[model samples]
Target chain A: MELSLATRTVAEHTVLEVGGEVDVYTAPRLRERLVELVDAGARNVIVDLAGVEFLDSTGLGVLVGAMKRLRVANGTFGLVCSKEPLLKIFRITALDQVFPIYSSVEAATGDGTGSGPTS
Target chain B: MATVRLSFSPAPVHVRTARLVGVAVARRAGVAEELLDEVRLAIGEACTRAVALHNQYGLADLVTVEMSDSDSYAVRVIDHAPLEASVGLTKLPPDELADESLTDDALTTGVGFALLAGFVDDLVVRPVEDGSGTEVRMVWPVQRR
Candidate 1:
């Protein structure tokens, strides 16, 4: 399925909102968005996956790659995901521990990480 | 005791459709709502890998998905993707495999194999008997966890 993307800045965090099935076909869009955000210096980022119908390994890979990119920039990466399917996949891959996942974007913005680098 | 079989081109577009069919099959087999996600992910990952492998290896093939509902739900995704020459990811030592050969762009779906192995109860990858492709097999029991 095709993916839809929306982005906004909240509390200095770049919130990338995505909806649709994120698999091999559509994950590139997500990856590119994350790359662009990172290149543009949005360190503290929240990937709002609340609207995601399904997330496979491909999507998970994109998240991992994005998180790694952010980490290199010394920024925190978080996720906003409540869907059972996405949660199950994240847990299955043991990625839940790797990412700071929140239930909502508001909570994600208030995560206190802020944007850019933090001391 | 029902079986659902689906086949499509080994393309990215068909991956989601195949996954939906897998979820439906599990739902019809009395699989719990929670477990349905597992089925959907396993199927999607397998299809993604198969499609990526076929495309990367420059092979034109078809992907076949089979779901059987008996005492448990068994799903299989078959692809005619040639064995990756360098990696030959059929079964490699942990150190030798780079996250299931998730090297370049197309192979990004490499994480799918790991997710399937960890989530599904019993998962296996075998070479097609005809020596043409690979088969990813996974099963979820009817008994809820």
Candidate 2:
């Protein structure tokens, strides 16, 4: 399936909503969008993955690369992922430890409880 | 035993098709519901790896996938890239392999293989018998009903 990416401002953060399958085929677009956001000076970026159906290592690699880039820019990067299957991928790769993950955009943006980095 | 075989051009777009077909076969083969996601992810990883190898090596040959349910639900993804494309991937631990092959700024080329190791409990990678490319073999237990 094709990947869909949309960005919006949330408080001071940019929330990028991602949907559909993220395999080798469509991950480049995600990467390019993320790079565009960073280049445009988005410091605190949150990716909302509530609509994502499938994710593979290539997708994970792109997320990691974005996080590292933001870190180098002294910015923050987080992910919003509640799906068990996607969560399982993070857990297995130990990426759950690397990226700040939340149940919702509000959590990541600290608008709500900022309740996660969900285990 | 029920078996299904598919062959597609070595391209990234075809990887998704392979994953869908694999999960469908796994579901029909009685693979547990909880494991269906793993099956799909594993299949995607394998097919993606094959596609990447083919792209890197400029191979236009087809990537082949076979799914069979007998002793277990098994999936094999084969790529026609040279055997050297897969060297040391099966031998090293995922992290160490990634570290070893890593460039200055890029993640290792074997990162997908590492993810495959994480997704599949029973996995094997070896050169094809005819000494052409590599075959990634992964198996999961089926719920016998």
TM for every model, in the order presented, reads: 0.80, 0.89
lDDT of 1 by residue, A1-119 (tens): 46989999998889999998788889888899899999998999999988888777677778877877787799988899877767776665556656778888887787455342111
The regions of model 1 sitting more than 4 angstroms off are A111-119, B84-110, B142-145
Proportion of native contacts found in each model? 0.52, 0.40
Instruction: After the best TM-score superposition of candidate 2, give how far the Cα of residue A117 lies from its true spot, in angstroms.
Output: 2.4
- Proportion of native contacts in model 2? 0.40
Query: Which regions of candidate 2 deviate over 4 angstroms?
Result: A111-113, B88-110
Docking class of 1: acceptable
The best candidate by TM-score is 2
Each candidate: how many clashes? 0, 0
- Candidate 2 lDDT over residue span A1-119, tens digit each: 57899999989999999999888889999999999999999999999999999888788878877877898899999999998888877776666767788988888998655576785
**Which pairs in model 2 have colliding backbones?**
none
RMSD from true fold, candidate 1: 4.7
CA lDDT of each prediction against the hidden true structure: 0.75, 0.83
lDDT of 1 at A43: 92
- Candidate 1 has a TM-score of 0.80
Error of 2 at B120 (Å): 1.7
